[model samples]
Target: MTYSPATQDQLLAIRVNAGIADLAASERFSAAEPDMVEAIVEGIGAFAAGEWAPLNRVGDLEGAKLENGVVRLPGGFAEAYADYVAQGWNAIAGPAEFGGQGLPFTLACNVLENLGTANMAFSLLPMLSVGAIEALEHHGSEAQKAAYLPKLVSGEWSGTMNLTEPQAGSDLGALRTAATPIESGEHAGKYRIAGQKIFITFGEHDLAENIIHLVLARLPDAPEGSRGISLFLVPKYHVNDDGSLGPKNDVRCVSLEHKLGINASPTCVMSYGDNGECIGELVGAENRGLMAMFTMMNNARINVGNQGVQIGERATQAALAYARERVQSARAGSPDKTPVAIIEHPDVRRMLLRMKALTEGARALLYYTAGQVDRGTLGDEAADRRGDVLVPLIKAWGTDVGVEVASLGVQVHGGMGFIEETGAAQHYRDVRIAPIYEGTNGIQAADLVMRKLGLENGAVFAALMADIARDATSDEPTLAALANDCAAVGEWMRDTASLDDRLAGSVPFCTMSAVAVAGWQLLRQLRAVESGEAPGLAAAKRASVRFFLDRLVAEAAGLKASAMAGAEPLYALTSEQLAG
Candidate 1:
């Protein structure tokens, strides 16, 4: 089955409901028109389905090769990337001053979903660059911005985030990378960095002229732990005073990781200053690298969530197509006794609905989070807070759902899914990394319960719950019951006394919160349907909402119960007993 992008009607509803239409009218996106936005989305979707989708399986089969010191992508990847750059898709949500289209970030989310659905591994090359562009735009020096933004924004060069080391995965405090102050020469006051960073995505690729690495290292006299770390702009090739590239910097891709999925995107073990000449300029202030890196990390977290949505959407489409065409057992009530499509089976229908509901729900939450990002940039402080609060939930829940839906997609395919030829297993493998990387889902849950809960002394979370409660109400009894369940769970979380109790239940709480938000968004979409917009798609939307409320929302009570269970039972088991 050919991959299909979201329908124009679906995109339009998201635009309207998320307030992106008004956002497009702002001076930042003043050049944008409704027709133009529609055209851009359609064009990109077409390019993705036609050019990129065909390469997904090929990418999986070919993977990426480390030829000598350089990384080479699978067939068609470089060409597709060039086409993507030439079409100006890279600049969709980039800074306008740097030659970007400066459209709303929400629109960028739509573009990412389409691209990611077509081919996830291919999509990752540009995805990491988006985070790099964000970091440079927010924290890079004026000179650094002038030197890098245009090319990175134009997709002539790609980017990477180098935070992981062999010894320091999630613990930034344990990083041993060193950055010593350099003296004399054109690069004085800059630091010469020497370190090894592992799991660096798109660290070295032939598709771009140069790779810009946002690296984290520590100064010689810096204090211990994460507090002393600093962010640096380290380019693969040195930039001259006149904006032209100079000789290659002292960085090399020592090796590439053999992964279960996303094989076309090279995960490299990068060595910096091995011969002692890798120069890097400090970004932001000294001992404040974590703060600066957060800019990129936050951007990446959202995009990661979109990855989940994309994979889920692709899996669902593939499963539905197969179910429709693959005839199976005879229907229970068939007088003719002829076999029917598997979709006719009640259990099969239930599985498809589960896939549909989860995919749609994830898209709603992700798009809503993207809209908040745009609002935070163009609107007030509250919008910024809302964006901050939703990032972890979106990243964790969206990805978890992505994995779940993709697994269901495989289940729908049955024997064929396990065989790999049907392509269902690839979706499952590709998405498994999402919940593990960009801050594991466990870490995200911890962030939600521990850090985000205290935002504005809890007013922010309270406001979010209030919004969910308000939108969750409906004349339909099922909807009303779901809303009450969500509200009751929210109250329990708010009133929970033990921090350990909250920690133990953090994952479930995050899941419960995401389902409620998704339920609320779908409810709003249903209201739009009642107003006679996109009547053709309304039935599917109604069914998805119904399935979400009946099946997924029903889990909220159990999640709440688990959340209230505290950490005592969790610790009751001895370490040896648990291991056994």
Candidate 2:
């Protein structure tokens, strides 16, 4: 099946929910005019379809190969990347001062969303680089920016995050990486970084001239645990002051992971300073590494959520195509016992509707969150807090929808989907990683309950839910009920529940919050259709939003009791008992 980027859906999200108009009106975003944004959306969709979609099967069938310590992608991967860079796609939302157009990040997200849907693994090479650009923009030294940003923004160089170790995993506090100061010499005031980092995406690829690593290591006199961690920039090739490449640094790609999906993107086990000569420069103040890295992680989290939308759209399209073409058993209500397309069957239609509703709902939630971030970028504190509160929802709930929709996509194809030739299985395998990485959904849930809920003394979340409540009209009964349920649960978690109880209920509550917000966002689209603003897709958009509120939103309300469930049952079973 050919992957098709949902350009119209993305446009609806951008224009209706993401507030592209506000962005266009801003002096800071003078480049994001209406026509330019439309051209970008349409342009990226075509580019992804023509340039990247063809490589989807090739990449999956011929995964990245490790050749004597170097990672090599299948044919066409490198050339497609070259086209991407040559066309200035990577610079769309980059810093204009550094060879970029400096457009709103919302547009960049649209670019990545299309690229990701067409070929997710290839998209990672640029996605990580963009994240790196953001990190340096916020926290890099002036010298660091001058030496790196221009090349990175131009896609001449790529970047990756060096975090997880075999032993450390997600526990940043248990990190054992070491960084020592260069006391004197030409490299004085720099650092010698030594660590083995695993699961580094595009870590050792030959797609760029060099790979810049943002490393987290500890200084000798640092405090214990995560607090002592410092951020460092370790490049694959030493970058000279003149923006030229120097000798190879001491970084090595020990091995590439053999994964179930995203095979085209090498997941490398990286060995930094293996020769004791790998050097790095400080990013931001010492011991403030996590704070600095948060800049990148936050950017990645939302994009990862967008990845969910990517997978969902691709899977939905695949399933819909198969359902429309495949003839099945005779229709239930027809007079003649003639066979019809599976899509004509009532049960099949329900499944397809479920997939559409869930995918579109997640898209609405994503655009809503992106709109808030754009508002926050324009100096709206209230908007920023609201966006922060919704991040976990988009990342966690959005990915969950991806998995669910992809699974349904497979089911829609019946036995063919289970077969490798149909390509449905690949989407399922690829999306399964979204919820696992970029801070696991469980981690997101915990963040929502333990930290985010308490932002501004709980007033921020309260205000957000209040807005949802106000938006949920009588016609939106599911949204209305869910708004009340989510609001009530948020208050109980803060005011009455124990910490463990709150933790136990965090996931379900997070899901409820997402469903409520998504339902309201969908309502915004329906309102637009009613106003004759987008008469083109009026009927289709209305149907999708109505199905979402009636079915999915209603189904999610059952989670309220689960969200309020205490943690006692979780701890009741011993580890051995649970294993048994």
Candidate 3:
């Protein structure tokens, strides 16, 4: 089923919730006029529904295939991708200096949301490209940027991040990939990279002329663990001095991964320098690859959060439509006793409202995070730190919402949701990968509890809570109170808890924090709806915010107990006993 766009909701999120007015008033984002923003949102919706949505089911069924070491996508993917490149979608938010429109990053976030909702697997290509673009724009040498940024920004060449090895997943220090400097020759300032990187998304695709890989590897004399790592610019095909395509590099896709979802996007086993000729240029300083890769990974993390919004929106659309059409038992105590549409049923209504509310809340949170990201990019240090704190919340909680909403969507469809043909299952399967990848939701929560809560001696976390409180209307104090409670948990984690305690309660704290933040965002949208600022979406937006507050937010307040629960109870059970 093609995605029915959530343009009105997205526009409301951008204008009301995300506070685009402040962004547009700034000299940096002067081009973000209301008309342009609306046009961009509408355009993305139309494009996704028309060009991208049709490929969603096909990609799931056909999947990307490995043929003679080359990855081939389902039919129409290449053409659709070419259309994506040609239309300048990739360049819309890129730097103006490198053939880009230089729009606010939030617009790009919205574009991805629509595209991904239409076709999540197909969307992975550009999604990965955007991350690579962000990484190169920040750390690549001027020469590297000059040679790579233009094409990458233009989407003529795709990009991949290579951080995972068979032996090293989250533990970067365990990585054995080695990069040895080639001291002399035509490629003198470069290094010979030799390693095997697995689970590389879009690692091998023919849609783009070249694939630029930002690899994290250790130099021969580098220190052990994450610190010794450095970022490298490796291309599938070498680029000439004049920017022409040259010979193929030693990097090759050994095989494509068989996966549970996102089959349209190639998850490849990449082998570099098996022939001992893989050459790469360093993107940043030695022993600082972690910092550089984090730049890319951070970008991906926020977008991965957006993936949650995408799948949730898609699932909601499918379930809502099914509920409206499927005939079911008569409403209780009806005089005529005739069958009614399932949408008339109370339980189904609750499920549908919950689905839409969570989807909208997740969308609002993603946009809020994106706005903070733009503010951070424009030099608001506090907003930047706030964005950092929001990332883990959105990534973990947002994906959790996606899974929950998708499951509910399945329930709305009854038994039909389980069968793949109905299309509800695709959303469930597609979104399942989001929480697993981009550092599993557990890792994101640990980052939230252990690393982020302590930023600026707790001031960043405090400021975030304060923002939520400020947004809370007197009529709706639940969100603010919840934020305060979540803030208390944050303080406890930073000041009182041991490392084990922090890690153990991390996910719960993250959940409570996300509920507060998302509730505040929905409140802002609710105010806009009530005030008639977004007249067209008034009723729907109002209901969504209300259901979120009355149901989701009210129920989440109980998480504080779990959030502050110490680690002792977790370790009380032996590993084997727990496993059994």
Candidate 4:
């Protein structure tokens, strides 16, 4: 399906119910006065079809070429990027007071997913910029905002987060980047940032006039480890007061690394202050770099989750296309004279269903989380309370599906999926980083367990469970069946304890939580579809949810078993035992 248009009657139903409509409705949700949803929809659709969609294959096939110390993107990127900017897409969810469209993130999430689905590599620049925007907006001085926000929002320039160094993989505590105060003269109060950042996405690029780097640096008297780190806005090229560009900053893109996927996006190794004059203005208070970066990290993590959803959707579309055209052996009951489309085979259908179910389910989960974020942003105090509880859960659970669902896509494509030419392999390659980057899935799990689990002293989770139970008690057999599964899984999680147990089984726990939460989201989506008796959409929602709970919900048993298997046994085992 090209674009699923929500009928006017359905829109009216949303107005009547006055409930949530997922993150993509952030603009609709936030606008105090009603406006045309079609405008946002048409705007995003045009960007997707005209700009982003046409670039995916080109990016994958052409990739990025490393020449001399710079990475050159495919030929059409700059033009497509210009188109995106011209359409005002970069500022779609930006602050209106600062030249943005003044829309909420949920609306941005919708646009972002389509971009990712079309071209993830190209889409990543804006994703990182979003994080940079959040950091600067929340923590940057008013002067800094005035200097940078307009350019960044207007897409005249791009932004990136710079935290990882050579030694700092997942562990930020090991960061060796340092920022020493300037001794004297022209640049007073500023610091010289001297460090090498690895795996810096969009660290250096030609798409924008300048790249604003949000660098984490340590002051001269700063302590060791993460505590001493501080945030700084170090631009690649200094900006003149008239909004003109000036001298290049001390920072430079030393080189770009060859990667398995997202080749269209430049991942660079950058060295700041090699000339002993890389100027950086500190953000917020001293020793608050990590705190500031976390906002970007948190936002990017959720966006990455959406990236996963987008990839899964793309793969599903590709696989469906392949299955329809590729002929294979006939099924047992079919006539033996001629071959049939692979989709006609039971196994192929099963795989397609699995992919469809997983992709749809993931979309629902991520979209619901975005809805929660919007609710927190625009909804009153009572609604904000619940949104607060869902953030980490959204981040953790959403990313897990990206990896899992993409893998399912690969499986459906069979051996052809392994080859790069088919494009299916690229989805798998790109998605591999989702779980690892933006704070590894492990860290997401740890956050969910430590922070989210205790939100409102766990009353929030408890209330959600109670609501599930209430729904299950209804005369509707389908919901009653769902309630049974929900109760079983909830009990398992509630009864479990110990970080060892949690860690040992964290991946599975993440998946299970994703399934349950997504099921809940599907129910809401079904309600949205059903409110106006949009049967096809409602049927699709029900089928997707049923497929998940029936086939995937049982995986909770495995998760529970693993969660209960504390690290004690593994720790107690001798090295010899591990060797065996």
Candidate maximizing lDDT: 2
Clashes of 4: 0
Candidate 1 lDDT, tens digit per residue, 360-395? 888888878887888788866797898898899889
* Residue-level lDDT tens digits of model 2 in 521-574: 889888887998667878888888889988888888999999998999898999
Which pairs of residues clash in candidate 1, taking residues 3 or more apart in a chain or in different chains?
none
Runs in model 1 lying further than 4 Å from the true structure: 476-496
Following a full C-alpha superposition, what root-mean-square deviation does model 2 have from the true structure? 1.0
Of 2 and 4, the candidate ranking higher by TM-score: 2
Worst 10 residues of 4 by lDDT: 1-10
Q: Estimate candidate 1's RMSD in Å.
A: 1.6
> Number of clashing pairs, model 3?
1
Local accuracy of candidate 4 as per-residue lDDT tens digits, 106-136? 6577677778877788889999988888889
Judged by whole-model lDDT over C-alpha atoms, candidate 1 comes out at 0.85
TM-score of each: 0.97, 0.99, 0.99, 0.90
Q: 383-421 in candidate 3: lDDT tens per residue?
A: 999999999999999999999998898889989999989
What candidate 2 gets wrong by more than 4 Å, as runs, is none
Clash pairs, candidate 2, are none
Each prediction's Cα lDDT score?
0.85, 0.90, 0.90, 0.72
